[model samples]
Target: MKKQVCIIGGGPAGLLLGHLLTQEGVDCVVLERRTGDYVLGRIRAGVLEQVTVDLMKRLGLDERMKAEGLPHDGFNLADGERLIRIDIKELTGKEVMVYGQTELTRDLMEASAGRGLEVIYGAEDVELHDIDGANPHVTFTKDGSPRRVNCRFIAGCDGFHGPSRQAIPASVGKDFERVYPFGWLGILADVPPCNHELIYANHERGFALASMRSNTRSRYYIDVPLTEKIEDWSDERIWDELAIRLGPEAAAHITRGPSIEKSIAPLRSYVYAPMRHGSLLLCGDSAHIVPPTGAKGLNLAASDVYYAAEALSAFFGKNDADGIAAYSDKALARVWKSERFSWSLTRLMHRFPEDGDFERAMQVAELDYIASSRAAQTSIAENYVGLPV
Candidate 1:
């Protein structure tokens, strides 16, 4: 009998897993709650770690990314007047790529089309059945019709709010979470980027970042109060604040353009233990989530799916469950490492309104240490460029 898998959430995790399974002659179905256009248009992380880029190339998904994506050697850490360059390649011998998650999703979507793989979009009433049994099923409603898909296993890549997380018994899993006091108010402009490398600025006002999406389009963010309203920030206020944080060096290059997209992303670190429950396995944000400070969100999701594909291939093809049983352990090893790295970076850059003198001094010391020590810099460089998967 052929082993079949039902993958929930059609994001990088689900789609990539589907593609990998198909290559191994395993039948798979992907169910997504959102339409293709919405998923492909959603603005998310743009940094691809070295490991993820390598996987894309090995999997034959790098042509489009390489053509359109920008390769960033490093990013700038600005302390108001002085700019420090953290050359990633010099420190880690690896380079990070700036390719939006949406672009990658589009590439995988187009590649998966007409491959005899079922991709159901705009699905509703999504649920998992028989998760503890050998045969797990994904049931959902499509076009007002109820549908049921039975498979040998189920991979949950549905994200933080998806239903797959609920399938695991609460008693068996421990939820760990830390919510930051501030959030990122991100914006995309029609203007070009102010600098060639991403700028991470720390100022008394707050934290600000200047990054790019493409040659002509720019993506920027400002650390703002969690309670701040988007309507309260006008173009003038945003530009003024950005100018102050980015400093005069970048002021000339900063151009005014229509703010096409704007939203606040709450910073948080969350993880759940034991990513598997019998035949059902979880991947991506469905299993863990880290703050975007380290640019590990999308890359980590891709890593989870990559591991899942390998484990499933071994289990079905060679009767090996070692990889499957060790899936959570393997993925979390990197997840927690990223979680700590993101938390450390976030603490160093973002200023808290309620921070005491000790905390502020501690942050300064951390930054100085990272800048002065080769080992500390290497740690940042390795994590920033990404670890081997």
Candidate 2:
């Protein structure tokens, strides 16, 4: 099969790119290694930066999200029993939309279907060929039958584990990463949110986050050591730990119930440099991953897509290679900034096992500064709400 572009991975990044291309009269095909249902079922962070929300609106995919998603002007940062509210809207005139990644994915899928999207689900062994050359093609199998797609360009929107990034010869690409020492033990339950806005708690025990998907569906997470096993954490134990970490004030608002979903997600910051090599370009998790603490993972991916789409649009329209050539540089500039923000948040909120007295004191001092200084608060609000598209 032939298309203008071949997008590997049907996740939000790929799907969003496909949507933008199709809207511009550029035809593309999306390949996914899993069933549509399986992709939608994967739980992920939901906080949407303005850039993402704007892109979704432009694609006409925001009807459901705008209606159902919660908008928070600010969030609370807890230090012991004290709550420090960071007023994002008040400080920066911006806010973040709280929606489930699952729901957003569903909306994207539905929008794609409505537009007659060409996506192949359950594509196995998907690989890219001749990306460094003028023409690129994708090879994969479906139901034991080999398939191929020849295209003008290839978009690697698959997650970090996907094949697109590896297609770039190690000689031409570099992977920079920092894996955190802890993981978030998260739980989802059908209960009222402990607060309208999220609370990120820094405690002596560890770090905890009180978040939600909707007014009635609560999602919470507490930092746990790598040695901790998921099987050992009963729902009761999770709540108990959350209460202790979140402190007495926030804990009083907790509405407990049976957990519908539970899992541990390791935190990390990873970026594959030069997001593009010849005709192949990486997007989203395919090229970078941010720790979930700053909620930049999906938003960063969307920013990558925007740069890619803009470049591709110019290339296909006026035969301009400048945009394409500058894609990696421009994308990486913002990528690194987000990496710093997420890394800073992770450092600020988590209790490092190796932290010395001075280190702990520094963390406390930084938090205190942000809570007291309007400038420090604005800096965080700007990054949290996102820099710019």
Leading candidate by TM-score: 2
The sequence of per-residue lDDT tens digits that candidate 1 reaches over residues 1-389 is 12389888998878888988888777888999999998887889889987678767866889999999999988887767766778888988889999888888888898887666678899999998889889778789999998889789999999999999898888889998999999999888889899998988888788999988888889889999999999998877888889899877876689878898988899999999888889888898998989888799988887888889999999888999899989989988988888888988888888987798898788777777767887887888888887778
Tell me model 1's lDDT, rounded to 2 decimals.
Answer: 0.86
Instruction: Write down the lDDT that model 2 would get.
Output: 0.92
RMSD of 1: 1.6
Off by over 4 Å in 2: none
**Tens-digit per-residue lDDT, 256-343, candidate 2:** 9999999999888999999999999889999998889978999999999999999988888888899999999999999999999999
- Candidate 2 C-alpha error for residue 2, in Å: 0.5
Model 2 Cα shift for residue 310 (angstroms): 0.9
> What is the lDDT of every predicted structure here?
0.86, 0.92
- Model 1, residue 162: C-alpha shift (Å): 0.4
TM-score of each: 0.97, 0.99
